[model samples]
Target: MVEQDSTFLLIIIALCLIFDYHAVLLPSAYNQTAISQENETRAESIEGTLIPSEVERFNMSSMDQDYIEDEMNYPPIRECSILEEFKECGTACEETCDDLRQLIICSQECVPGCFCKAGYTRETKGGCCIPTALCPLIKRSTVCGPNEEYRQCGTACPRTCNGIPEDCTQKCVDGCFCKEGFVLDLDKCIPESSCRVTEVCRENEVYRKCGSPCQEICGVQKETACTGCIEGCFCKLGYVTEEKAGICVKPEDCIPPKYVKCPGNETFTYCGSCEGSCQNQMVSCPTECGSPRCECLARNNYVRDKFGACIHISDCISK
Candidate 1:
């Protein structure tokens, strides 16, 4: 019994020492817990490494504030204002120094000429701005000469030249013209009219001058009215004769009669003539050559005798 008790006492003492070491007697357990918590906290801190600050940011100046001056430069020049110019020009303060300034001045106080396109011309009361093509007056004098109306046109278009104040030379105006027979025409001097007589011809007529009177008036003959006159004959005032096939001539002609046949077989046979079939055998022909049958047959055949009688061509030739 005593040995069992002693053994039990020793076992109890060892168990108590182990419990105290783990609970409070020794620091191993607490140290391990502290180390584990420190490692966890360190890992968490490393995960969020970046730091923020409250410092202010630097600023920059604007481009406009850097290069621009606070004041205007240049002298005042008095000149005509161009309608299209952005700024106006004023009196020049000083000749030499002002001239060097950005201001531009003209010889006289005059308005600027109108705006001209690249290839156009612009004229103003003071002067003109002409393109090379629109107005070729660049090298030419403004005034051509005395007594000229046209202004020497230059490379500019829509330009006006001095009229009557300057005479037009070839170099002055676009063109020059003079009256007929005068020395000058279109900037060129010419001779007078050479024709001695200027004949005026009327409608349907042309001027004809021939050596003989007959030759002069011969052109007036109508082909249908007078095919041709006999070799030795001339056309009469009111009537004309035509040459037949060869030698025969129309001494008597057919004319419109005063009266016409009204569908009857017999006519007045005088003071009238018929063109159609003369069924009216007695109708009178206005020409009064002779009997109706005789005149009709004779005119158609052209072998009629002077008395309006029809004769056979062979008989007439034989006679």
Candidate 2:
């Protein structure tokens, strides 16, 4: 029994030692955890204060530098006083007119100048400003009519045929035109009898040029008023005349007009002939000459179709 009692006491003492050892280790672990937490808290506080201040200081310094650089680069502006008058000055124009000239300052010291008179522009062609209407017409080659009167190309010139006004649109060429009773044949003026009047007007046949006349015997009546005494032939609406063949054909049968190198930077495209209307797709040619010819109409790009009609890029897809 004594031996048993001694064994029990030893066991209890060993248990108590284990408990004391555990208790001692628990405080050390707790201190370590507290210390780590305190260090993390301190680090966070320092970062929050120091990092923001550093960034703020950097931004402030950059702004200051930029301000200093801008101040150094730009010159100080001086305010001019309204009352301060200089030695050099000129009389200001005080005229009130619709076509008034632009204000002119003779010198830096001068006050605001007077306005130009009505109908006058500020353009200085010679010495003084003049009315825009009074300005000389640009000296283009004068186109003379059958009456020896000046008329612009495409203008309807007056011609007396059978005591009636033959309304002829002038060509681009400038020279003395044919007389009243005569029509232009090729380059020369000739009598109407000398010109060939088509015996049978085609489906779209029409009279073109000065001396050209339509035979009354022909099935087609004159659709339009007689524009000229010339015997030049042209196709009517929706038909185009072949350039080389001089025969009226459908737009589908038209050969694409030959390209003529137009002078100057003026951009041109084929129009009027086999070329479809510059205005739209469905519109027909204005003249019988099916040959597409270069024409100046603003600026546009054109291509020929398989049917030989000149079409705008916006109207058709390019092959």
Candidate 3:
């Protein structure tokens, strides 16, 4: 009876050992192998964060409880292999609180809509959020800056620029007029030193020089002195006379003419003239007549000279 009892006890102990090995040890080993493979796959992705969608997929998979528990026991995987990466995933590390508060650095050419923390402005250089240290602050829903003029009369400002009155409000800076040397013709200020003098056609009839005044100048109607000559009959060349004649004449003719008696004819001489023919090329003088030629001059052949001489112009030409 003792020997039978010993054999039965030994059989029972061996069965218990086999059952424990298959149930616990084998499954544990398999779970470990699966978890190791999972970690290796996660390492191949770009970002260093686990994808939540991938975790969902993994939980939904038919993996056994032993494998799932083994996965949950380890630290969160650094990456995800099953799902695509989240675009707006926080750049900060969850392990550190400081990283959460700090804004992410960005490339110089980053586009708009990039992630930035609140209380920061998108820098002109990059889309990165920069502290609004120098930028205008919004107070009472108003934006005012150092250089810019502000008007806070109402919810919507009565006007935009501050310095000038509302009626004359424009984008003027400094004084209202153009800078020195420059005339205020255009909308913006320009260097007046470059401009030239005005073009004056006449004293009162001054017109801006061609391409000047930057606009039209004193019109013809403004010049009352140029009345008769308005249509255009200016004095002859080498002349200096006013436009009083209403007609232009030689500069010398501007004054009255003098009268003299025709030497031989005793006729008044307005201008030099001769009757038929006269000797000694008579010139009209009040008291007496004078002549250079002693012999009589031909009437037709020898025409009158400008000085009332009866000498032929043909003779003069021939001579």
Candidate 4:
């Protein structure tokens, strides 16, 4: 009975080995052998023995278990995804809108896998491939007016009369830009020579191709401490700008800011000209350096009251 049982076990292992050698992956006709043929010589010698050694038996059992586990755990193969097709000889190089018009030399070697469909290219590197017509660079072509040229990818903030920004975040854009020797002015491309003529500088203002953004403004004096330059009309030397009015004036000519008014007689000032608090009535108090808010009325001969309102010097003294 023991000899018969051993023979039966050997037959079952041989059948498993034969099935493992001819196994195929699902959804495809590709052949993939599971076990190595080096073990075939060792398996052949075991057939002569009535009962195989424990090591030989363990090896056979492991080989059979590996084959069974592989078939049970094999993942289901899927068809091509959207905008992709199974090609027998797919190109190693991918197509994109940036280089779609350029010539590409692809290998004709067999590489059976999914690839982008006809008339479609990869949208971005390792991104969802989309239709060729939907590409923004394709649509932007020939959209420029005379003297202007279309760019597939260029600075969105083009060189204007004000000047191009140094730190331009929106650089990757496809649209009409001024051609060489041309500058954009009021949404129209004109000769570089006439760029300044279009941008007429006002009095006490000068047009700078590359000017500092930090300048003297009303109640705020500063020097250029910027990382980049700004192109536009800037206040000339010995001149300061009143930003709200969009005009330049001398430092002494800057009108005290009155755009903001407090309740009652109190007025707002960027450079607090008044230093009188409600508890301290100072009609002729010296202006101190600080972020002075609504406290007192400068040059109005008034002091702050307890209710945060400005009152005449005589009224506070009388109380």
lDDT winner among the candidates? 4
Residues 1-319 of candidate 4 have per-residue lDDT tens digits of: 4355456445544543454344333323223212223334322121233224456557677776565445446464544545566677776777776665556687766676657788877655554446676555333434468788767777867887666754467647666788999988777889888854537789877777677878767777354366678877888776778877789986545566556555666655554554575576544646343453554554576766676667887787565
Q: Which wins on lDDT, candidate 2 or candidate 3? A: 2
* Per-model TM-score on C-alpha atoms: 0.17, 0.21, 0.16, 0.30
Evaluate residue 224 in candidate 4 and report its C-alpha lDDT on the 0 to 100 scale: 38
Off by over 4 Å in 2: 1-117, 120-147, 152-182, 186-198, 207-235, 240-319
lDDT of 1 by residue, 196-227 (tens): 34354333222322211332121123323333
From the highest lDDT down, the ranking of the candidates is: 4, 2, 3, 1
Scored by CA lDDT, what does every candidate get? 0.30, 0.39, 0.32, 0.60
Q: Using alpha carbons, what is the TM-score of model 2?
A: 0.21
Instruction: Please give the lDDT score at residue 172 for candidate 2.
Output: 43
1-319, model 2: which lDDT tens digit per residue? 4355456445544543443233211121111111122223222122123212334446766766565344335343221112111222433432221212334444334553223345543323212333344322211223444434322232234332222234444434323556656665555556766666444555567555444354221112233565446544456655555556767766445444345454432223223343333344454546433223443232355644455455555656543
Q: Where is model 2 poorest over a 10-residue stretch in terms of lDDT?
A: 24-33
Task: Tell me the lDDT of model 4 at 96.
Answer: 73
Ranking by TM-score: 4, 2, 1, 3
True-vs-predicted CA distance for residue 155, candidate 3, Å:
22
